[model samples]
Target: MEITIWDEYYELLPRKELEKIQLNRLKRTLIRAYHNLPYYRHKLEAEGIDIHRFKTMQDLKHLPFTCKEDLRRAYPFGAIAEPLRNIVRIHSSSGSTGSATVVGYTAGDIEIWAELMARTLTGSGASEEDIVQVAFGYGLFTGGLGAHYGAERIGATVVPMSTGNTARQVQILQDFNISVLCCTPSYALYLAEVAQEQKVDWSKTRFRIGIFGAEPWSEEMRADLEQKLPIQAFDIYGLSEIIGPGVGFECQARAGLHVSEDHFIPEIINPDTGEVLPPGETGELVITTITKEGTPVIRYRTGDVSSLIPEPCACGRTLTRIKRIKARTDDMLIIRGVNVYPSQIESALLSFKELEPHYQIVITKENFMDRVDIKVEVAPEFFSDEVKTLEKLKQSIEEKLRAELNIHCHLRLMEPKSIERTSGKSNRVVDLRKKEGLT
Candidate 1:
């Protein structure tokens, strides 16, 4: 397999030299965090740590862990290290849980973000000649602008579709002869379905590469997407707290996502104990921004569960790669004494050829006990009027869910297009337990 290299200087930087650069950046970031941010300053003082004497990467473990709550407590601008005038752009989290956490970027920070994005696009098999259409929503969300800047930086013709208007998105994909598509994984699959319904011929256009992220999807989902869209689908990972969609990207090998070690440091730690686990041990992902100047974070707990692959990738990039996220620590659901993740349910549902990847997990309290019910939509052809056939299908799905989720769950089969679809991130889980007066 042929792989595209974006920046030979940094992407292929020597390990020793890279570490030296990281240490320098880490020291500078800590200095700024200690002197500029009150929250970080207080935390460091309470720990009896001298920010000026902060030494090497090994010292990362000694620093305090920053969580989403820290950012929330700091609110919009307290986390920022640079002056307000230096900030050129800001992107914020959706704050579905609470107050939105804001992330700022200086002029230089934006350039670095664009560079990382360019690397992401090229690493996913895109080129300067390819026409890239970004379907992620723009504005306070980072997905749209992050992808837009990166594609432009790579000299690709960017459509800047910026989510919604599914009909128009299809029209642009066909009319513009777009070779690369960027959006959430669920949106990609949804587009494939809509395009087929509109009789858009794939062979006529140059649509072959898909860059998907902003949600956790299974390998089964990837295979289903590849078969449905006839494209090489690659997973890109990032968050607003980090640098949006360019923090890590998969190469042609598709084994793991290579992190941009020159700018960010990745660590896996036990969610409960906070002990940094060795490579290949699954735990919550923690990150520290080494080069970020606007709003640098130290040991920011991402809450994503995955392991590090210390082994060199076949693509020849020496940067360490992280296994695709299995499930976020916070996304894990406890039901009937068993821990379950939505991706586990998704993997089981997508395994069946007769079912679509569209499903919803509904959690509600029943008689003081937690219950999980999955409502899945079957392929249009698989939906039948026969009661026996439908029941058999439901039984098969329930059995598979039991094997994968390790707990029996109530399963219901629905007709095609019965579940709500979105061009943005798909809301797969509907937890009604809270509304039922259970905390």
Candidate 2:
């Protein structure tokens, strides 16, 4: 019951048969969307879309894409194809960038999400007897519920301890002898620190596989976490817009994440133009949810930079996979186990017009320490080209970075062009830890 083989049964099926199944599902979703949802029907009608005539997947490209803006404009429950009473649960984003994208799931949709998650768990060797501790927050957000249901589906004993209760989370893992753990990779590192602080015997614990997401992580960071916790850490990818983390997960091979393409279609396309790129070429990851019953998105541009691998996986799943994400196009920065965005810094920096937007962040290493330094060019007219004025500005910027980024930043105020500015995007953080020979 653990590892149900999907590829053996369906992988060798004719490509056209798989296409037919996908087409049938797409037709059902399209009909549900066109008849029940006002936003999609009006938009499709405006575009003169003959929904009936579009029979193939390529034909789907003719329809307009659904962006986060569309969800924001509609707000909560506007995109739902089913009645409110029929929805078993809701999931949402913070809308910090714009309006929050609200998602509803039918009872069946919840079951489907769980089934995919179970596949994630067991495919990674998580067993029914394993005590699974879910460390994500439970709410309208997708992270907690998605993993909770998946762990339960695999018959693993699930502990529903939500995020931010690090002490409590650590206590439960120590008390119950939990095996499989899930959380953002950053939080996992934080929890490991607590285990060290509390003098917990990590070796005596049953902890095994770690499913981590909600932030970008590096292989170096993974090694760091594994060294502390001494367990296999995995990268699970998902977005609230196109289902949560169950879309794909890492198998033992660690080569690439095997996506549930049979349920969700994965494609690498040009971010700006939406042109489909070749398999090996790097581009944005776009997902089309073919099997989702609620709020199915079509070619939703994920804005995540990565490459696609359509070849058969060694894990016995013929599903297409993607390489590790390089970075997000948005102004996001991860510093010392925290998610910091430029807007968070911009809001802090804009408190005074004395500072200019023409600033560069220098993330350097010195004396075996990870340091974040912000080198900025203040307005020339506001401050004379003097080191004293620069020092004053430096103090101001450091306070703001601490307040906004939640991490202390060494602020260096320089004369205009002290740090070169390009007409294009400038480097925000320069990580010099490796060049200095510090891991």
Candidate 3:
């Protein structure tokens, strides 16, 4: 397949030239944050860090790290570098954990975002001839609008079907002759299930490419999705804190996601000590947005865990690539001294042919000990089998999970479509220990 690069000039720039551009933008962003944002200004001044003296890219480490907590403390407008008058748009987190972290964007920032997202779509094999359907949630969430602007910028026909109403979405998929679908990976699976239930022929639709993000997924899930849906699934990585879903994307090579280094710098650091790790070492991802005019974050610690791939990609883009995110620092679950991620369990479950793609991890405290119970849906044919056979399959799944996770866990086999589905990010883990007032 021929690779499509939206901005060949920057995307294909030599490493030395790209670094020069990154250095300049990095300096400009540091100055903007230091002078305009009070939180950043105070942090810099207290640390005795002089933004003007930022002569080299290495000086970035001397600066303080920006965490989600800092953004929350900044609240509605503290972190915004540009004045409110210049800020033309606002997007925020769900604040389900604490206070919502609000992000602002100037017109220039939006333009940069659109350009990056256009690059994202093009890298994922989208073109102007494709009819794109965006199902990411709109409004406060950035996924929907961010993708919308990018599809339009690339001159692709876009259907802004902002999440929910699965039936309507399936109908549009069948009627609109949509060529590209954009949404969370889990939701894509749900859509495929619904379409199958409705007896819609996947080969009849024009859907060919699926750009999935807003949540971490596994390659196993990708294979499952491809098997069920007639589309090439591509992973797009981004967070609202770092300009939504266009930070990076996978090329046709599918080796790793190419970070748009001209606009944002990517780094992998030890999550515990904050030490920048060497290439190929997995750690938390840190991003610095250089061209952002509004909420410019310096060394922002994105909790997502991934590694930097230093090798050149077959797609010929020189931008740095980060491995697809499979786990997050915040999402790690410690059960009986064993560290487990939902993706690990998902991979293990998907390896079995008799199981469906839907599953949930429920963590609770039993007798002051952490107990993990996984509930997964079985294929209809298997679900209707004799009890003895079902028990044997359940034991086999438990053993598979134990071998994969390195910890024993109880497995509950559920009937087909027993687990509830979501139109947005899937709720795969439910930790009842917190609700039970257990530490």
Which of the numbered candidates is closest to the native, going by highest lDDT?
A: 3
Q: Model 3 — TM-score against the truth?
A: 0.98
- Model 2 stretches with alpha carbons more than 4 Å out: 1-16, 332-439
- Shift of residue 39 alpha carbon in model 1, Å: 0.6
Q: Per-residue CA lDDT of candidate 2, range 224-307, in tens?
A: 678779688888888888888788777767667777766887778787787788898888888878788777777777877778
Clashes of 1: 0
Ten-residue region with minimum lDDT total, candidate 3: 380-389
For candidate 3, write residues 1-439 as lDDT tens digits. 7889999999999999999999999998988887888998888989998889989988877788899999999998888887799999999988866889999999998999999899999998899999999999999999999999999999999999999999999999989999999999999999999998899988788889999999999999999989888999999999989889899899999989999999999989999999989999999999999999889999999999999999999999999999999999999998888888889999999998889989999999989899899999988865644888888888999999889889989999887889999999889999998888744
**Per-structure clash totals for the candidates:** 0, 0, 0
Each candidate: what lDDT? 0.91, 0.74, 0.92
The positional error of residue 306 in candidate 1, measured at the CA in angstroms, is: 0.9
How well does candidate 3 score on lDDT at residue 203? 78
Per-residue C-alpha lDDT of model 1 across residues 1-439, encoded as one tens digit per residue: 9989899888888899999999998988888888888888888889899977777778889899989999998887988988899999998999976899999999999999999999999998898899999999899999999999999999999999998889889998999999999999999988999998999888999999999999998899999999889699999999999889999999999999999999999999999999999999999999999889888999999999999999999998988999998689988998888988888888888888879888899999889888888888889876788989888988998898888878889998777889999888889999998899745
Span of 10 residues, lowest total lDDT, candidate 1: 51-60
